[model samples]
Target: MNTNNKRIKKGKVKKKKRIRISRLILVLVVLLVIFAGAGNLYYKSASKAVNDKSTKSVLIEVPNGSSVKKVAKILKEKDLIKNKSVFISNVKGNEKAKHLKAGKYKLAQNMDNNAIIEKLIKGEVYQDGVKLTIPEGMLSTEIVNKLVSQKFGDREKFVKLYRSPKEFSSKFSFLKDSRISTLEGFLFPSTYYIKKGETEKQIFEKMLLEFQKEYDKKVKSLVEKNKLNLYDTVIMASIVEKEAVNDSDRDIVAGIFYNRLDKKMKLQSDAVLQYGLPERKSRVLYSDLKVETPYNLYLHEGLPPTPIASPGIKSLIAAANPKKTDYLYFVTNVDGKNSYSTTFEEHSKNAKKYHQERNDLLKENSSEKNKTGNDENDNKEKSKEKTTN
Candidate 1:
């Protein structure tokens, strides 16, 4: 009884141990397969997310009547997704492969594989979206910031180029130091669509081309009539652009600036002072008069060295053909929108009034901007005002 009982117990124990071992092995195999599948899926998803389509393209050009296979190859070439073979397989397996239309596709990083594929097959055509609405009379630095925020170009690089425009002028033969120091006045304010990550060279070419076209359309004939060169036109246009905030005032402001220039009086334009300020100043200080910069129209008998800001079409035309007026002085009034004054005394009184008005406007602007949570920009502007005042 004892031997048989002991043998039965040992057998039962062996059977239980074998069952436990088998269950453990089966669980490990399942876990291994699951982990492998998960790893593969993650790898594919991540690869698709980071791999940008066609150098961060806003559009992917698909030739007309291109086959599914051809589109897959193009996507692969663009580094948009993985496995052209796999993509082709998906398309062929898709219920609508035969209906796959072709055209330009706007794509971005982080678009999943299926989303991009659907967009391409649906003939979604969206070219590089670079909509920029440039205002008249913005400083070069402000322009740079706007461009940088829009992701068209690097702000730091543009700033560096703006600071040293002669280097760029050599590259673009049309511009000289006198006409546009660092391409400031020649940028030609307008709504521009420049591709993101575009090279500085490309952006410059686009802007320069725009300026050239504008000159041809608006100012070329007048330049001939007035015996003015491109340089003079741009310089005058810059002043007009700065002074003429409202569209209707462009011609009238041009008349005033031209009259002052012809009379050999200091332009005494606060706009020029604002433009020339690096750190930004609140008011044009007495010491700012002797700032020894070519842009200091207060010291220079003639025009400032170059345009302070990129001029628009209206300003360009106004520079070429100023309205007939005997007014020697003009001052932007308390609103910072309109002006008041003709004689020196009137101008001085307006300036004094605007001094407080401008300060209040600046402080108001600073508070509003800070309310929008841009304390850094507000502080920078305030610092600029302090330096100017």
Candidate 2:
């Protein structure tokens, strides 16, 4: 009876152990399932696009020496990535991430991380057209040089085309003005994406079209209301673009020029004098102002015969609608800030103050340079003395 009872007890113990093992196995299986689902959800979220339905192309430039983290930040900022951490992890995991090139890339919002990484690694940069960025206040000759350097057209052909606005007058009505001889200010300074096989003439036409659009949008109504022709307004805008250092200053400078114009006072713009010179210098000498040219505002009473350089849209708007002020004269300081004055005596005082400040700055710079040279010589002498000793 005792042996049978002991056997029953052992059998019961074995059954309990089996049941506990089964429960442990079941718990582990459930945990595995939960973990698998969570991992799958994370993968789906990471792999998906920020906007799968949108087809808008965004241009992003990955500058030289940019790391994976920097590129990820750029993508995140551009709203091209769903998660920056996922992007970085994916990039680090991919062997091709090391091969990513620096350039302007045209990426779409529909692209996933894998697609973007592949594109960047393969260096599939935007090459749909030639990029031509003509900055504001560039002289026509400078523009011609830029085009020639880029192998856009022959120098002589570009120069000839630039001088003859009549060539493009048939297409652009703004060029119909009898006074419009050169296409200086009419080139419209802006970034242009020229087609692969476009000619110089077509390029010029594109710029002129842009100019027309901008002028009509921003300056046309104002010019018409002010009883100013497009030619004169563009000329003034060109001058304003060259003179003013900032936007607020642009309007005020335009006003000063208008005031001078109304009073029949000479514009006396150093920029105009510099424009008429054969070559541009860092500093325009007093003698340069005395040189006889239509563009020399000091010598000439009115606007230059042609616009000095390509006037940007802001300058164009400022010229059309100048800020009303009693200021007739302005003198720029060493830091590009202008001091405005309503009387000649006030203008003279401001000019003297700026001139003295500039002179003092120059002397200080010269003194620093001399001290540097003396220190270098002293170091050399000390080295020689030490070697001899």
Could you give the C-alpha RMSD of every candidate to the true structure, in order shown?
19.5, 15.5
**Top TM-score prediction, candidate number:** 2
TM-score of each: 0.54, 0.64
Predicted candidate 1, C-alpha RMSD:
19.5
- Residue 217, candidate 2: how far off, in angstroms? 1.3
Error of 2 at 317 (Å): 0.5
- Badly placed stretches (over 4 Å) of model 1 are 1-127, 159-173, 176-181, 336-342, 346-389
Give per-residue CA lDDT, model 1, range 126-233, as digits (tens). 645567777877766677788878677777778777666676566566676354547777776676667756787677667777888888887889878978777877
Best by lDDT: 2
Q: Please give the clash total of every predicted structure, in order.
A: 8, 0
Per-residue CA lDDT of model 2 for 330-384, tens digit only, reads 8888988999989877877787687667656756787755645434444434323
- Residue 385 in candidate 2 has what lDDT? 29
